[model samples]
Target: MIVDDEQPAIELLEKYVSMLPNLEVVATSYSAIEASEILKKESVDLLFLDIQMPLLTGLDFLKNSKNLPKVILTTAYREYAIEGYDLDIVDYLLKPISFERFFKAVQRYYQNSDRKNIISESVPERNHIYVNVNKKNHKVNFDSILYIESLKDYIRIHTSTKSLVVRMNIGSILQELPGSQFVRVHRSYIVSKNKITAYTSTDIEIGTIEIPIGQTYKEIVEDLCRS
Candidate 1:
């Protein structure tokens, strides 16, 4: 789904989406009202929305949707970023979007949906979780993290590119992370699938660093490896 008043923007986005595999443009609209009508009759997995539109803005359209699809906001204004994040959008893309950035945003949406399905299938008991560290609250990108390890009272978060230290219990941190991509491999350690490099019975290596695997968590680790 693509929505924009500007014909060129819609055309460019359509071209970009067409280049990707397994993605089809279900619909495109110049106004929110027209989009609403189309949405009423069809199901869309992704929406490329423009923020500034006459009558009903993209933000308003999203808020009014009964079943909202993953949205990527496209606009010339950068000020709407905070609002977009507040709405829990997949990504915020500025006007004249680069091919690389557009691809990354689409990739993020796919990854999020994939992990969500895995978690929903595996654990139906949990709803939401939170983790606090260094006096600053950090919401974990469940699919983006590789694992975590306890350092005294604090925990070190190892992602694909960087490691961050947060002051909190490992248990609390695990709750905030997405369960599909993360598992408690050891009492002190949590690892993300994308970050895992190597593993053995007693230890797991992420990149160049090795974390000890607790005796109790060995079975969990083995299960993950087999899966």
Candidate 2:
């Protein structure tokens, strides 16, 4: 699915997507509302959405949808990139998108989708897990965490305002967080999309601190941006 008010942009995307092997441009709409209607009646695996559209923007469409597919935000402005990532979009493409950038975004989605499937298969059925922090048992909400940082043998949990330190491995803590919201961006850092302030290829800024992005976790971070 592709939603954009500009015919040229839609045509360009349609042409580019057609060249891909396992992808298809299912639908195109000038308005978000029209796109919503189509989505309600059909199954769409991916959405190429324009952020600035009449009647409703791409963000508005995402908020209103009951079932969301992988979304790639297409916009003229770069300012919305952070917000788009916060919303867990698949990728952010600047206006006048080139074929190379578009292909990169699609490839990202495929990789992420494959990884998610593997994770989901291995996940146990549970809502929450216990974490021992500072010799006290702290019941952490899976969705409330912003990020986690490893400091020697202790791991710091950054919530909306509060921070808790627990003596545990970062990998152990990551297992407790919901896979959909939390992602490891560095060897020492795991971030929650709901609490991320901003991010780049090098770092993810959460609240007042900037967490480094490890080379091993770059693909995961990019996947997080597209989520």
Candidate 3:
């Protein structure tokens, strides 16, 4: 079941649902009131719910409802994250949702679900990410990335083999990459922790290249060195 206020979001989730063989869309509602009414009749396994609605907000509805299924909160706002997690939501997805991120969220749902009928292919470790470059989605292995450099509106990802210029901000791309493997040492740079050869308080060395560590990141850099 998918409950969202916007028609486009519902359509997009429907498209994503169609891609998975095991997943099925039982119901879709534009408002929380309509969804509550549908829930009385339908036996839903999982719910993709939006945070904001007209009559009753998603959070308010969740608070008042009984015998609710496992929920995955879909919202554009980041402020309600802590409250959503407190309600024991399966996952919280920020919108303009990518298929990759959507797949991960579904995997989380399956992991948390008590149901035994699980899709084997739904859960798999991902080592690569697909990014749009020159109107084409290019698969770049996480291990191949040496460092990432910000170029105002665009970011140049420096890989071991080659560099790809992508039209994304530094902060947005950091969220996509694995946090454990990468560290942002400067405002304009994010370096792979595994790729570092040497480091001082002011700079980090990756083979022949030396990347300066910014003032704000000095403490974190020092901590990394200590660890």
Best by TM-score: 3
Residue 111 alpha-carbon offset, candidate 2, angstroms: 1.0
| Candidate 2 clashes between residue pairs 3 or more apart in a chain or in different chains | 88-227, 89-226, 90-226
Candidate 3's residue-wise lDDT over 1-227, tens digit each? 99999999999999999988899999999999999999999999889999988889999988999899899898997667546755767777789888878887787677556666466554445688888999999999999999999897788999999999998877567656665577778878889999999998789999988999988778768877787
lDDT of 1 by residue, 1-227 (tens): 99999999999999988877667999999999999899888889998999999999998988777787888899987656545655667777787887766765675577657544221211232333345555766655555576677786677876566667877666545434444566666667778765678888888888788878877668768777777
Q: After superposition, how far is residue 43 of candidate 3 from its true place, in Å?
A: 0.8
Give model 2's TM-score versus the native structure.
0.54
Model 3 lDDT-worst window of ten: 116-125
Scored by lDDT, model 3 comes in at 0.84
What is the Cα-based lDDT of residue 104 in candidate 1? 59
Q: What would the TM-scores of all predictions be?
A: 0.53, 0.54, 0.56
Model 2 poorest ten-residue lDDT run: 116-125
In order, how many clashes per candidate?
6, 3, 0
Question: Candidate 2 lDDT, tens digit per residue, 139-191?
Answer: 77776677888876678887765888887756446534555567778767888
Local distance difference test values of all predictions, in order:
0.74, 0.76, 0.84
